[model samples]
Target chain A: MLKESLSSFLRGCRTWRLWTLLGWLDIQQRYARSSLGPFWITLSMGVMVGAMGLVYGTLFGQDMKSYLPLIGSGFVLWALISGILNESCFAFINNANFIRQSDVSLWVYIFQVLWRQMIILAHNVVVIVVLRIVFNVKGYDHLLLFIPGLLVLLLNLTWMSYMAAIWSARYRDVPQLIASCLQILFYITPLMWWPHMLKKHQWIITINPFSSLVDLVRAPVLGAYRSQLAGVLPLFLL
Target chain B: MAEAGDGAIQVQCLKDINLSLDKGDRLGLVGENGAGKSTLLRVMAGIYRPQEGCVKREGKTVPLLDISLCLDDNATGRQNIRLRGLFLGLSSEQISAHEQEIISFSELGDHIDMPVRTYSTGMRMRLAFSISMAVEAEILLLDEVLAVGDSAFQAKATARLREISDRAGIVVMALHSSPAIMKFCNKVAWLQDGAVRMLGECHEVIRAYDQFMHSKEKTDA
Candidate 1:
């Protein structure tokens, strides 16, 4: 079973042309008639970060200068991680027709989901740039770490999405269950709020896998690595 | 075979089926509705894995089970050609080389530039058929795709199919029409209740199946 899964994944990866085009076509079809096209991904993400940064920064008695960049980078990273998890549930089910008709490896569908989410994440990078400029955040030294961090995160998501695609294909309700679980995880993870808020209960963030994965990407840009980098190293090793 | 929703009962769709084909072999499968003809074809195409036995195949296999399977309705005919070609495992360079050939064969003219959603049923089928035929397959698994497009284009499509199948090393087709079977296949397998009821020369097996159908019809009347 392991050999079969591994071979199927390798075969699907080798067919990068197919999935890349399929992913691009998905983005095109989504914004076909609209003028803003995929810029809507940036526009919506920017609006959410702006609105939430103001309200949450004030709510938690934090300065906007430090808090805005945190929310901006954190939200963008969270969207990518959550989007892959949520959409992977439908990876096999959405391509049911092609699955039934063609002998393409099942991983092709998984890669398609990941690729489109990555494109959305790329668009959201514009929001990150705007946040950095507006807030005058400086962390260019740590930016190089983003490469290895993203590689680990994507490798973890690939296997996860593959399993989710297979499991959700069999059980119809898995997607809904996953969506609800992610909704709860969203509030608990340190996206809008600082992890230091739970001083005595730092274990909450430590135990949550989502925290480290988000921190891997968000910490580099916002230059806040001291608290979470120690926790993240062991997770990446695993 | 497949399981029920409750997972308590296992429904076997095919069993005790030992079949093989080599280069230059053309096999036709004929059976009543629900006799597992399509299921067997799917098994050969590697879409459904058998619980008991294994299917061993060599060479590239292309199953034209549903020619219109992934043709995006919002995309233009030109883009759909590239999309389908990619799914068929052709590189971008290969698809571009054959792009003009497919468009000309499809006879879409200026309509090829329009979105497929704006096409007539026949026009849509023409585009799909043209794109599917563009692949050069060593093993071709076709399920009732021969009768596409209007009558005028039907003749062109039949000739195209014949040329492609003639070039293919192995061809397995599930068809209901006896004439089509005689035209394409050298051997025939008549399936009954998930088992091969008869397997022999095409003419001999078709004769027996036709007699059985005639008697059953008279008895029903």
Candidate 2:
């Protein structure tokens, strides 16, 4: 099972070039008739963050620069997680033709969705970058670590996408259940909050599969990492 | 009882499961809706492995399961023909040489540059059928997918299919319209309730299927 999943994901990643182009094809197809085109995602993200960040920044008594990265990082990571989970659940079902007919590898469709999300997230990052500059936010030197982290997250997400698509295709209920779990995890996750402030129950943040993921990547990017941040390995971070 | 629940399709939905076709024969499958007719063709095409018995194919099996499996809706018709042809099992060079023939055959005109989504369903089928012909594979399987074309276009499409079968491919078309079947297929297999009720001359199987239905009605009454 592991070998199959691994092979499927590797095939998926290798097809990244074609699928990424296909993902762009879909984006054009989706947004072509509309007036706004592809900015709908980033536009909506901007509106939501501006409102929430203003209200929450005051509530938390934080500056926009400091707070915006918190929101920016959270949103980027959430988009990655949410996009993968949302699309993978229906991957096989949606590509029934490719599943039943295409001679090419079935894993190509998984990469198709993952690349689609990465593209959309790349668009949304423009919003985040704009917010950071607009708010005078400073970039973390360790932000360079995000390149590796993004690489790792994508590698893992490819595996998850394959396993999820195949699993959901068979079990029937796994897709719906996974969708709800993702929604709940978004709220439970500190998307807009500081990880350190949850000192009383930081374990909740630390134990999350995405927690290590977000901490290792996002904190460093937002320049929020303390000297002790490097010591924050998987288990002991909380 | 050819039961296959775990993704292993063992039962060939073909009933009667017996037929003999001379070389260069065109046969249609005609029946009412929900008939096991398409399943029969799929079984023949190796898309659905039969559960109960076995199927023998002297040549390769290819089915028009979907158009986009070969052509993405957003791609140009020119590219789609090559893509779809390659998908149907042609090598890239083979696809390259045949691309022009399929494109011109589609009669898509200047619209060939447009994405396939802009084309009507009939036009899409035209493009799909033309590409399938280019592959030069034996044993063609289609399922009422031809009705999408205009009547004149249908005649040309039928002629292309007929010519291909005459040269090589063994044709098995699952259709509901008896007239269309008669126009194309010299042999027909009648299927109902996942069993082959008759497999013989097109008219004979049609007659048998009709009689069976009439008897069923009398019994129900």
Candidate 3:
């Protein structure tokens, strides 16, 4: 296990270059002949977040400014985590040629998919920044706490990337299952709705490991929430 | 490299293993259906890495197994060449300097600018053979690249191979034309049942193989 993990970590680091290339290649292949390209992702997020923020705010009786940033921040970070896990499963599947023929490191495939997610997340980051600026949301002034939290999130995603890729490599049905799970997680998590509103049933949200991750980013920035028990389960699970 | 594996390559449709490229020599391989030519060539390439023993390469080696396999279809041939070249043990700087020469040699035209997925099989072979030819490794492992394309293209490739040989590089290839093999290869090794049955001068071994096959044909008749 140690040897495998060591090799995996090394290969994982080495694959960063290959990951960038493949992510770029995938994006190019997908958007070829299109002008809007990545901006399409931007446009879709804008529309979805705009519509979601408007509907959920009025329905939940929350302030629009406070609610939009919460939803936007929650969705953005959750998507980053879920996106890495969701996409990591298909990394090796799509590159069957390289897996069978090319003898390069296998971990490179996982890195490529995760890197691609990071790219899309990067494009969506504009939404977060825009939400912060437009809604007058205050970000954490404590860079120390923020940095470590982001590090934990990044490290956790890396683990998920490995697990997801290996699972998919073994079973072809995994990627689809993961996609559905992400959809369910989005609904179950307090992403569109505020966690505090579910005070009686808050255990469901608190038990969620992602809620910890979500609060790590969402609470500090929104200043309305602090992770009391949301992160404990996942921190221990990890 | 990891210790070799015990797995054996099972033969299915191969005709028979029977051929050789002599010691310290450049050889052109030629044979027909069930001739076991390419399979035998792969065994010789040391790709399978038999669990028992090893295929020795006294010097650097390069195997042009399949031109399409030679490059990642997703990457530019130029970029693919760099990684492929390094895998073949060419330093990055050396690969960089030789990039223009290899692209020019393949005569792939402007298509080299695009991903190899855009390339036809013949074009892939041309690029592969050209790059391997340029690197001129000590031992060249080939798999029937000569007949990969148009006749004119074949002539250009053959001439290029000839030029490669002139530099004292050793070539081991599989082809379907005995005449082609006889024209270029100095020696031959006839393989049967995954073992070398005969190894000597090309014309002599091929002649013996022909006569033996002919007598068997007559007996069957």
* Count of backbone clashes, every candidate in sequence: 0, 14, 13
How many backbone overlaps does candidate 1 show? 0
Q: Report iRMS values in order.
A: 1.4, 4.2, 4.2
Give per-residue CA lDDT, model 3, range A1-238, as digits (tens).
7897688578557645555766776776667669999888777887788998898888889899788988887777877888788878877777764553334566777777777777888888789789888988764564236446666777777777777888898787888998998888888888888777886977888677777776776666565445444454456475
lDDT of 2 by residue, B72-114 (tens): 8877787677556544556667877887888788888888889
Model 2, position B12, has a per-residue lDDT of 39
| Residue lDDT tens for model 2, A89-207 | 78888777655654346777787788789888888888768866776667567767777767766766766787799898888888888889888888768887877767697778756
For each prediction in turn, the share of the native Cα contacts (below 8 Å between chains A and B) that it retains comes to 0.74, 0.23, 0.03
- Taking the candidates in order, what DockQ does each have? 0.73, 0.24, 0.18
Best first by TM-score, ranked: 1, 2, 3
Best by TM-score: 1
Q: Per-residue lDDT tens digits of candidate 3, residues B104-196?
A: 888877888788888888888888777776676666777776677788877777676666566666778776567777877787766554445
The worst-scoring run of ten residues by lDDT in candidate 1 chain A lies at A224-233
2 against 3, candidate with superior TM-score = 2
Evaluate model 3: give its TM-score: 0.74
Which consecutive 10 residues in model 3 chain B have the weakest lDDT in total?
B13-22
